[model samples]
Target: MNTLQKWLGPVLFCTCLGGGLTLGWSATTDLNKKRSSEVAVLQNALYDQECGSCHFAYQPGWLPARSWDKIMTGLKDHFGENATLAAEPQRQLTDWLRVHAADHAQGGKIQKMVRSIPAQATPIRITEIPYFQKEHRKLPLRTWKENPQVRSLSHCATCHPQAKEGSFDEHAVRIPNFGPWKD
Candidate 1:
């Protein structure tokens, strides 16, 4: 084939692939939103308990089923904080958490999170995502004045409504009374 024909075929293939990927991400985000809704319902049932109070599960599927198992068993010393959960309650939650943990290979939430994480020596928490940092980086000092809901950095869903959808695009974020985003 001529040079023009060869280039045209390859370019068209790439263009189609790129478009497909973008569409896939959009669909996946929608799925995440739906799944997040279920998890949120589960969260509400645990009103007496505050598992997600300090920490976050931006990508709940990031850890393996076994990881949540380990954490559930040691609630008192949970990663340092006292995440102590009662025995019966823990059993219920442990099963629920494991069920939602990421299991897929390509678009699995847990796999995506693990890949995004740096291979640094330090341990990492899901709350420390770059998007999370960018959103809350300027709030440490001012966080005190905010309402109780927005006080914690884990409340990404409060400001960014699409957070549960995995839409961390800064342009799509709405930071409370701050209005639309600058970035």
Candidate 2:
């Protein structure tokens, strides 16, 4: 009826709406940060022992289930080495890897890695993933070849000190002789 009375209702509604939106935005942003920060750490002891014995026990989230399946099936000639496991352990590792692979991931860098691959592509090597290549494109070939401490990009832990822990944050990288990466 009067100017003050008429304006109060709309003012209160607008204030409540804005406050709700602010809170919602804050919550969403935090969730996204948590998701995007890292992939899941290697949790299977058998995988860690069997794979880590020869190379970095790369988190399964780096590749899709199809890729993991391919890799598991080809362990006899794994990257020019015979990495064949016994029947039981091999089956168990394959199952675990597929379950946690990128395609099945909820969110985070793992999901981004999955999205980078073509739907038809089944890349057995994590280094072959488009996302992995893009992220490492800035590095010179010498870093992987000449650096005694970092002989290959496949050696994720050589630069990503926390790769085992599933933390691939660029800020934490220490590229052996090359030092900290900045890009």
Candidate 3:
């Protein structure tokens, strides 16, 4: 075989292999339209259960819908948390969880922007994100309680523009009490 044939052959083979792997990864990604839509609709119904009933459900696609399924199906024994759900209802929750499972989900806005940071670092919440903390670090925690509407992170939408869209985008940030504070 010619020198060009040998060099091009391995490169093409690797590219195809890499592309196939990437396609497979995307196939398993939790952001698929069908599953995400199902999760979006269920999000509202989740509030009907109880306050903190669905804490952080909309924060990030943290858990792949599948992992969400496992968690809900075993709600009564939910890790260390005291959450619970009925068998039939758990089934419904499971179906939704499968699509929005933590494994496949993006945790929060910080995660979306982590590409610019060190991957070895642990993920952080909206309130814990560096840029976020830097901006709101001056505020007192008690201030939030005194004004229920301002309860610390209750106003996440004040900055994360996508909070209304059921997603978080760092570029959309505009901290509340600073600008466009009204949610």
The candidate scoring highest on TM-score is 2
Instruction: For each of the candidates, give the backbone clash count.
Output: 4, 0, 17
Badly placed stretches (over 4 Å) of model 3 are: 1-60, 65-70, 73-82, 102-155, 180-183
The RMSD (Cα, Å) of candidate 3 is: 11.5
lDDT, candidate 3, 119-167, per-residue tens: 3444333344354455455555644545455665646554566664565
Q: Which tens-of-lDDT digit does each residue in 1-183 have in candidate 2?
A: 699999999999999999999999999997667656688765788987898887788888788889889988998899899988999999999999888878866666787788999998998888888988999898887877778888888988888888777788999999888888998
Clashing pairs in 1: 61-102, 61-110, 62-110, 75-84
lDDT of each: 0.57, 0.85, 0.49
What is residue 82's positional error in candidate 2, in angstroms? 1.6
For residues 29-136, what per-residue lDDT tens digits would candidate 1 score against the true structure? 977665542222233355224565564444445455555666677677866777676777777777876776544434433345545545542223446544334445
Full-model lDDT, candidate 3:
0.49
Q: Model 1 shows how many backbone clashes?
A: 4
lDDT of 2 at 23: 100
Q: Lowest summed-lDDT stretch of 10 residues in model 2? A: 34-43
Ranking by lDDT: 2, 1, 3
